[model samples]
Target: MGVLESILRKDGRKFMKRKDSDAGEPGRALEELRGSLYSDFHTSDGAKRQQQRLCGPFVAMTFNFIVAVGIIMANKVVMGMVGFNFPIALSLIHYLTSWFLMAIFKALSLLPASPPSKTTPFSSIFLLGAVMALATGLANVSLQHNSVGFYQMAKIAVTPTIVLAEFMLFSKKVSIQKVITLAVVSIGVAVATVTDLEFNVFGACVALAWIVPSAINKILWSNLQQTGNWTALALMWKTSPITIFFFMSLMPLLDPPGVLSFNWNSNNLFAIVISALFGFLLQWSGALALGATSATSHVVLGQFKTCVIMLGGYIFFNSDPGIVSLSGAVVALCGMSFYTYLNLLGSKESATTSNKLLSKQNSFSQKPKTAEDDVKVEVNTLSSV
Candidate 1:
């Protein structure tokens, strides 16, 4: 998966070239779509700003968590009439549709967007994009079998997961504060994971499938974004095509077509179409955030997402979080906060500087001026004097 991430970076140059060329007209539609979603669904105004700032990722994850519950409930109702499970079908359908839409968008980009230098090739990016899609798709699949709150707990687990990834892969040393934080987050996972006892065995197993890629993708996508290798949306959008291809290949072998073919009612259809758009937004925003920061920090901060969703679940369903869940959440949140604070403090810039050493280097690079300019200025000054 890491190698695949490394390979996808090569395609970023090509993707960026396409993005620049299409900035004028044909590209306007997707930009418009992204802008509309950001404004209407993402950005919060007025008093909500602080709420938005405090738990940035939480708002989005809550939206996703709610949608997951909605989809499951909707699927149950719809399946009653259609006599088939849509969730199973959706595991493949969502990717299939999203990728196809992206491919068409890519085609349209060719019409108006200018092409970039030929140095970047398609194969390089295709592999990385494929890795991204696989990671994202399996993560989504985890939600199908797991309850929102349970899945959310697993989501919180991604923090320590990434920390471990960094430690093992990058040889980073852990501090005492960091170790304590990890312990707190681990406790939260225990509370959240233990409660869904009826079917948790399966839910947890599926969630682990997601956790590995989620952590890897977080770290990989972060670096890819830092180096300007790929714009955030393009990485996820491009992979949709490859994801579709892979899903399509595997679905028939695993699930039946009769499972997908359904009685299309207006309401259920609306639900799915809406979910698809949200899915895109979720992936894009997530990629944007990861690309903007260190993956380790990004994952650690993302713990808030699970907290919000768990709280929201309690409100919506009147589901009791109980003592264990509450304690776990607090501990996990504190750990993440402590870890983030230490990292930020350590990275702070110092005021002291020695610019005198730079003076010679600056003087050596200067442009030459005529000596007469000195005489001219001197004569002018004498006349003024």
Candidate 2:
């Protein structure tokens, strides 16, 4: 009986040990499964967040670059090759098409709703739209009168023009480095204009006429976005109608009578329609870039576009902008690039200064208030009283 009782106790102990081991296996498997799931979720979430962070600026820049270059080439073909001599009319078509597209985007919930009228005043929007019309109109006129290379070279003047305008109008101060760079840019543009075989007085005057309005337009666009938190599409939607009105009013005055009699054949229609579509994309992408970046960055992108467009003109359009003109463009580009760098550096310095001030204030607030501080405050209050 003693031996049997000992045997039963030993078997019971063995059975209990086996049961404990079996229970642990399931828990171990469950923990492993949970760890695997957590790792996968962490990896996927990190990748998605990274993509979202990068997508905006990358897409904006790429969109601006491709459409900007393509639109210029397409417009050159339409205006120069297809003999679409009415610059104002062409601009009108572009604005109208853009407005229609914006409407569709609004309906589809792709674009944000227009801001409240009180927040974005009609007068300001109207002014921007009018200036936009004048800027685009003069651009087309300049393109119509000038070779593609010369037109693009003239656009480089806008950077310096913007700098001067800001200083004069808003008391904005630029660094000496930026001033020197802008001077270089101006000299380079003058050299290119002088050397350009295709340069005519009217074309040059029109190109020169374009610079101020263009500068103002860009400044206003940048200001509106940064200060008012305006999205590009929303701003465009509000301003397009004003632009259209300006275009319509200018059409009769500027566009010649032959528009009605001009042949609207399939080829011509197709070319013009395509050019107009590119025009809409140009406005959208340009606004996207300006909003995503800054006026300075936009100008830098424009400088890059200038280089590509000039090269494209030489290659595709058989433009013989002599070695001197090309050299001038190179000088201007180098100057513009330097100016952009200086601006960026200055911005970073300012940002750092502001951050330091904020940190100091935060640190002071976090510290426990001492009796001396309270005494000083009380003293000041009594003194004021």
Candidate 3:
């Protein structure tokens, strides 16, 4: 009986050890998996950052395209087809709505709160706001006076204007390839859109006048983003109030005399509200795109948006696109594609250079002690001892 009891106790101990080993096997496997995952994540950090950088421009471009198309369609329906014909008044409503929306976003803490700018004064912000208001208001006026095709042609000018302004004002250098791309895009837009070059002197003047301020506004927005560390929302919030004030002051002067006499209906009211909403979105998206990329890229995106809108017009409004238009669009697309490829190549090269630098830095920081270092350490230790 004593031998049997001892044997049972030994068996029990063996079973407990077996159970402990089983548990530890899973824990060791889990630890190995965790280590593998951590190593992968650490190694891919640079690639992840590159992907994020690429995604910024992509997201910004998409937002700009969608909001721009919506605004263009809404504006056409409201001002041209519906005969609301009050561009400045519409702009005023847009600014007001934008300010209200920005305020709501801030109140809800949906956007990060940016402290007031130390480098950029409030006066500079207000001036930028005024320029933006003027540029957009004049653009609307130009659209009212010009045909859709002509308006799009005028828009094509903006890219070159911005590029030229950057070169002249900031001494910024654009690659020859990019410059050629811009030229191709401009020519394509002109061929695709300009069917009948209807020259309204007033419209021409307004379009030309807006170009300078529009260019300046884009550059200023980019600068402010870098210098002020401002997000799209924060910049818009700061500028919206001044824009609203400017629009209010200009509306009375610039709106057509018949604006007050227009018949009020549910359709008009709905269109106005929708237009205002789209306008707000346009401003927000445009700011985001400009903040994410350069002014030149923003202008290129505008050209792309024009191409899409032209296609949309053909499909939805039965606006016949000629063979020339189709060919021009293809050319424009090719140019944009080539430009994108160049940008990607540039980005990859930059990332590779950065990685090389980082590796060198790490090697330098983690370098092993030399023989001289060891000798000095031994001498110091011996003296202390």
Candidate 4:
């Protein structure tokens, strides 16, 4: 009987051990699944951050292209078909609309927080806005006085002008490779767009005059956003009033008389308002692109936009731009693509160089200071002074 009881107890102990082991198997499986899920979540989050960084410039350029093309087409309909001949007045309306939108966005908390307005002086914002307005007004005047081909030529010249202006104003040096690529882009655009060659002293003067302000405007827009940490909406909000003031100041000089006599049909009003909305978008998107990329890149993007517009016109409007023009457009596209690739490569190299510099600095900082090193530092500081 004693042996039987001991055997039963041993079997019971074995049964209990087997049951505990069976329960732990499912527990271990669940823990493994949980760990894997957590790891995947973190990996996905990292991937998303990297994707956003990679897509930042791409998204900005895409927005700029779509809005810019839409605005140009819409303005044609409003000004030519709808007969809203007052370009300056239209510009004023655009400024007002943009300002209104900014206010709404601010109220809705849609725009990201930017540095305080006080950080960027009122004068600087005012100057930027004034230049922006002047650039617009001068462009209109140039277009009015010059042939379309001459106007496009002047527009193409803006790339080099901006490069030269940056070098002169900021001591920024562009690579020779980039310069050559830009030259090709300009020639291609010229070949593609310039058909009629008309020259008037007044037109030539206006076109030349238009270049400086345009360059300054682009540079300031880029600098303020990139360096000042200004959000595009915030900057646009601050500048819109100054822009509106300039448009009002210039309307008398630039806009033809009898604006009030134009037929005020609902269709015309709607078209103009739509164009104004697009104009606001154009301002925002241009600022975004400028902020994301350099001023020169923005100008190149504008040239790309021009090619796309011409092709689109040919496709949608059934207007023939000739095989030569199409070929030029193809060439321009290729040049622009090459320019983008070079820029990306340059950026990677610069980043690597900067990282190396930062590592050297850190290592030097981490090193124990010696009397000799301290003496050398003091001597260098005194020499700098």
Candidate 5:
């Protein structure tokens, strides 16, 4: 009887041990599965975030390009082809349309509002507004006087102008490579657009005059963005009203002959409305593009837009873009591409250096001095004394 009891006890123990092992196996397998899923989820999430970061700027740039092209084409049709012939009035219509759109956005709470700046004086805002008005007005006059291709070619100078303004106003230094790139772009533009047969001295003057204010306006916008933490819409809202006021004040001096004498028709009215809408879209998209990317990126995109406009002018306006002009445009675009590559390389190096410094700082901050280390330091100091 004792031997049988021993055998039963031994068998029961073995059975219980096997049951426990079986349960443990499933539990460990479940934990491993959960860990693998968690790791995969994190990996995919990080990849998605990276994609979104790249896609956002790309989308903004593309939108700005399309909108800019549409606006230029529309303006060329209205002011150049349709004989609206009212540059100031046309500019006024643009601002009014922009203001109306902004008002609508504000009412719907779709526009992001920025807090008012205590340090920024009203005069500064007025000055920015005046510059905006003058830049747009002069650009329109230039466009009216020049062929579309020549007008776009003239805009190639804007990049170098901005670079020059930065150097003069902010004491910023550009690299020799960048300077060479700028020279190449300028030379190419001169070759493409500046022909004695097609060039009007007045138009060239208008374009050159437009460059200074445009550069200053961009610098001011960038400054306001960094210092005031203002969004694109907020900046637009603040400046649009002042811009409208300035345009109205200047209308008397700048308006064309017999402002109210032209016969108004549905086709002309439709063209005016379309041009105004395109103008508003141009401003909004341009602001958003600048907000999404840097000024350099904006300028690079501008070069691309100029190329597109130049092509469009050939197709739509029947502008004679000679071999020299086409070659010049290609050269200017290549220089811009080179400049962009250098800028990107510099930015990457700067970011890497910054990251390394940040990591060193974090590591230094993490290591606190222990009591023993403090005692050793004090002892060393006393011994040295």
Candidate 6:
């Protein structure tokens, strides 16, 4: 509450009293005052649940874009001032160093939580982190073989993999609309890949690897989010150490062991900060959202990431968002929107049915949580090549 706004407690009820000033209309002023809380301050149950439903995947999709775009721009920025001489070594080093910083931040956040039980198994998180690292490495390798289309298709498949993984690992259900959204996004990705129709078998194989761990991580993280209650930073950091381990283990497996060199350049630091800033903001917004409700709903809703970037690239990068790409974005986004709407309806209906069940005094107590408990997991940085 600002000082100029009068505050009063009458009959033990608090009310805001705003004085007339240059504050424009009272409604606008009131909305401005409540700006920070607008997303979560809804008084209606329906609205609150709706946000809960859309929060997870939305954040996940947004995070994916931020990380990808940041890295692309950062690489371009570094090359303009520096050069590719540093790419082979510095890129890898920057990635490792950023992992260390992320881990430090995550550790700081977990300080107040009751110490992680010594017996709690972390093997799954470790293995999943390694999967992400390998998948990312494959993505890096694919960059050398094919055009941008290949990259988009390979990554877009992650959404469907997530849906399937959820069902296999946690018995999650998907509506027809979500299935449609998944297919549309897949088409966008595949069509994007067709930009390089001459992709070789090896390149295609490398590209396909991008989706495997991506989907796996999503499922693992969704489970973790539901049960872990850890901040995104902490979860990321906690799993991050495993990536280092994965890298170390890979050193000897190559023809000539690849070493992760130290590159403590200014550009490296800049990329790290940008990555962390985006990570902090995007994840925090998502956490607030998931606290309210379906991780799956959020993912399906977030495919618009490709659409926004496609438009921006067309405008600034001189590459046209071709009729095909634009149509793909539209089709994909529309399908995702329908998926989101139907999922919300299903959740609300399920909640209502459960409410009725409670009122009936049935033999069995009503089970809570209308939707599957979901976890959202992701790893992206702005420093990768």
| TM-score of candidate 5 against the unseen true structure | 0.75
lDDT tens readout by residue for model 5, 52-115: 3543556767888999888877978886777888888899999999999989987875555454
Q: Which lDDT tens digits does candidate 4 get at residues 53-124?
A: 544788989998999889988999997999887878888888899999888877875544556566778888
lDDT, residue 333, model 6: 64
Give the top-scoring candidate (lDDT): 4
Worst 10 residues of 2 by lDDT: 43-52
TM-score between candidate 3 and the true structure: 0.78
Model 3, poorest ten-residue lDDT window? 42-51
Better of 3 and 6 by TM-score: 3
Q: TM-score, each model? A: 0.61, 0.73, 0.78, 0.78, 0.75, 0.62
Could you tell me which residue pairs clash in candidate 5? Answer: none
- Model 6 TM-score, all chains together: 0.62
- What is candidate 2's lDDT per residue for 295-381, written digit by digit as tens? 656776776666556656788999987888677678877886787677668778999999999999999889698999999999999
Q: List candidate 2 segments past 4 Å from native.
A: 1-62, 146-157, 192-194, 197-208, 292-300, 311-320, 367-385
Clashes of each: 4, 0, 0, 0, 0, 11
How many Å off is the CA of 44 in candidate 1? 29
Off by over 4 Å in 3: 1-55, 312-319, 367-385
Return whichever of 4 and 5 wins on TM-score.
4
Residue 7 of candidate 5: its Cα lDDT? Answer: 100
> Which pairs clash in model 1?
8-128, 21-113, 21-114, 22-113
By TM-score, the candidates rank as 3, 4, 5, 2, 6, 1
Clashes of 1: 4
Give the runs in model 1 whose Cα sits over 4 Å from its true position.
1-84, 87-124, 146-157, 167-176, 198-205, 253-257, 313-319, 350-385
Please give the lDDT score at residue 274 for candidate 4.
97
